[model samples]
Target chain A: MIATKRRLPLPLAALSTGFVLLWVFVAAFPFIWTVWGSFKVEQDFFSRDSWWFAIEGTRTIAQTGSAFTGDGYYGAWVLRDFFSSVVNTVIVTVSVVVVSLTFGTLGGYALARSGYRYTFWLLMLALVFRAMPHITLVSGYLLPFFEMNIWGYMPTAIIVLVAINQPFTLWMLHSFFLSIPKDLDESAMVDGCSRFQAFRLVVIPVMWPGVITTGLFSFLLAYNDFAVTAMLLSQPNQTMVPKIASFLGTIQQEGNVMFAVAAVVSATAPLFVLVLFFQRQIVSGLTAGAVKG
Target chain B: MPHRAFFAFIMPSLVAMLLFIALPIISVAVQSFYVQHERVVTEVETCTPFAGCTKETRVDAEATEKLRNEEPLGRFNGFGTYLDRNHLAVSEIGAILSDNAGFKDAAARIYNLPFYRALAFTLTYTFVVTPFAMLLGFCIALGVDAIPPFYKGPVIFFSLLPMIVTPLVGALIVYWMASSQGILGATLQTLLNDPTLSLKSSAAMTWITLLVYGIWHNAPFSFVVFYAGLQTVPHDTLESAMIDGANRWERIRFVVIPHLMPLATFVGLVQLMDNFRVFEPIVGFSAEANATSLSWSIFNDLRGQVDQLFGSAAATSMLTIVGVIILLSPVLVRTWRDFNRR
Candidate 1:
């Protein structure tokens, strides 16, 4: 195992894959555990009975053997407002996705195309807002907006989401925009298009691949954002990320009753949204401080 | 014609950039000086409408603005709030730099070192996780790249799930897993024969748990990046390498690594920035603080301190940003040029 495989030890590879999956399992556990326990009775959710209670432990010491029927999921749905919550999530996520993509794409194009004096500064500026912990910014601005009586619903969530989205959109799209040769714009202009016209007619269509990737990445970003949305809206139905965090908060009180709904809905909704716009070129729009042209 | 073209082509984006991106940063820099005009020690300086403040004295001035604005910022004396002036105007750039002692300057406090510590920690994290993920992602992509008639479509679907999931959710699961008796801890305790291994320990547990968890949560994104990079790796070189009896290592190191370098470098930088700013996972993950970092300073200034001395937090955040730029100014320039060239 040590000597014969690829450069890294074979055991290391095995351990690496094991560790990766273990990490994934751990990473995925809250959702997975919540989803699993969501199906159990309240008493069963407690330990001494544990995750894999045999038929003896689950049943009433009866003839055959049985676990509780799919009551927990049903409990989550009927009692927890989970369906409504899921619907709210759908609305929030879909709306965020739609909005972030629209504005972020256009903004990215402009930054990519502009001859501004401080391009790096502007890019860094946009990214700074995004990268600075959302809690810090939201904690700062949220109260001000609240006092002005301005921040709420689509306006608040979407605006905050869009602001966060714009940074990545600008940096990522700059790359995508740059990747497309300047010839596309120049040739289109030579054919009698104005600058805007060339961008719209010639550049945009070609930049479509980059545009979709950048925009979709923006959507995913906003779709998962928690800290700002948690602070800004505070309404149960406002943003799913906060709502999931809210559900986690109540775990001590409701335990499995609510977490089941949180785990599945938060976990599944993003996945479903990603698949809807899924593609071959979804190389993350975000890179480390460096990314390739 | 030119005016209309410029307005139509450029105005909205520039305005948006100015309104959202530029204004926020400039405001933060400005707010740092005006912070607690009575309490702060540094002298004031003005530039433009911001009520002039020296850039050096300004910290995460933004956080101060956040706090001051929270309860009616401008209703009093022109809406600016927060500051940390030297007040004394010392001759030799102050005592802290010269004497190498005492916590006199804003930059010398216990909370100040976290940014530097986080820098080293984040850089190590970025360097550690990226190349391995790049390779691992390639292996996964290759496994699915030329899928057989049966396994073709599902492998991509199976493999890319992590990319689709939210990092918050992933971090949450990590919290569960690394909790003292989290499945990982319990399993490891038994395996390693250590009864007293806590996830909150100052040694390996806290940092390693966080990094390992981060790497796990992040690999999918890297996978997608590398997979895309791999798809574009021309076939001829790979085939020619194989034909020339070059070993896999030789081929990957000589042929593949260079080809992957540009993308790898880009991803590496992205990892650096993201990992350094990692707050959510570490914040609520366990009680122990990554206290040495700038984020903790900002958080403490805002969330912990009474009277909401937002000036301190703002200063901390400003310091944090400067630290970020200092760490990556070279990469930032290269990246700027790369985007502009086309």
Candidate 2:
């Protein structure tokens, strides 16, 4: 039986349930509709006469007796060669995660353990950088990169993304390390190991969960980034998000709107799967700050 | 860790941050004081009797290239770009103030300046979106809390969809739906009984759509935070309040919200910083005509293929940093105090 004091009346409960379901519909419907629409002809999917025409079939598709097509996916994947962008995105994201986590773990652990005034200042400084928009740094990099002739390379972008990811990485990892007791490493040190040895053997094993959570965020940041990748990388070196943006640029002139639609769906699919699998880590990562703050 | 170990651990991050993050800021600040210029050499061609030609001046490309190589930083013009119409618009403001114009007229004149125009929308976006997202998020948290436990995970997962997707992709999803040919757009047009009314057609509608998208994209974050906060609200206090005849609204107003205030602040601080950038959505919406932001202005200046306005973009970036510092100072001050206390 429900607790009499806590449970609301049936009418009120029903009303709230209805509202919640409505909101869920609002939140999830667009992606579902778009995914379905991606497989249909543009006219049928965006039919003027009825919103259900895509489900029912478009004029051209109906006359031809077909309800679905793959032109969007074909044009995007085969014709546009978007797979290279997928490769670029994976390379950048992986490099950013690996490089950033290495620095973040060492630096954040040091910050958490150190009692010096500089540690506080360094963390605070990272906060300032954290708040800075990446576009600002892109402008600063342009002239120098042009002079050095390294403006449009994937490695340069990956390095920049890693640097940009560092502040948040350090902050989160710093907080996460603070939760682990210092005595574990100290005991290891007392037992005849150097500080680095103690950290490698004692602290690192327990730090994996936090590091994994932090790494997930770093990966997301690098993967989802648009401004830095869009501005910094040249045409051939463009990542997936920027490539999708490039599609938007020529979408009108080339009549490849469906290509963009297909690309958007494809780009979102990984994130959906990531959220499903790593939902716990993502949630914990989000709330970690909330609880600490 | 000991001092040597600490230094060893921090050195790589310090170097990276110095080279990439700190140096860029200094570079931008320096660049803001300088303008890029094409080196021009004026040469006089004297008419000769044999040639029987008029004297003419011509550009010297080699000399230009040499000068550019020698002084790549360009000529120093300290605060000139910042004070110009593209940025602070100090002179334009002075003119408007001297005229003693009405508020609306002065605003119109000021909005003509690119910097102030972007500032206006950026500020509007920051102030409006933060509060609205918080309020809507709180409501959603409450609504979701009212339901049974089995439904929570799926509801939260779907809610996460809007925020977890890339900002540009998420904004495009909403933007495409709000286009005239899409279902919601078509339905809204029909419901309004006007075939021609389109979200793409109006400035006010565009701003509203962006705000809605902003709230949609961000509210889930606040919801997740607040929902976690909600779970920790003491059942004893709620039960006592109920025994005291406290209704749902009263109990919520007095008990629930107070408990969540700190969490709300966390969400607000994060949202303020995130929303202040506001770059990707504007690009995604292609609402550049109706709306521009500080970040967008920086992007626009740097993106011109043949004409990169480096000085102006740098100055705008400096101003944006200043704006972020100003807007976030209170939080920073509190954080500093808290850190000191700890």
The predictions' CA RMSDs to the true structure, in order, are: 10.0, 2.2
Relative to the true structure, how large is the alpha-carbon lDDT of every model?
0.55, 0.89
Evaluate model 1: give its lDDT: 0.55
Interface RMSD of 2: 1.9
Proportion of true contacts reproduced by candidate 1: 0.13
Q: Which candidate comes out best when scored by TM-score?
A: 2
lDDT score, candidate 2: 0.89
RMSD in angstroms between candidate 1 and the native structure over all alpha carbons = 10.0
Compose the digit string of candidate 1's lDDT tens values, residues A129-165.
5555554454455334656686655566666666656
Per-candidate TM-score, chain A? 0.77, 0.95
Q: What is the alpha-carbon interface RMSD for each candidate?
A: 5.0, 1.9
lDDT at A266, model 1: 45
DockQ of 2: 0.67
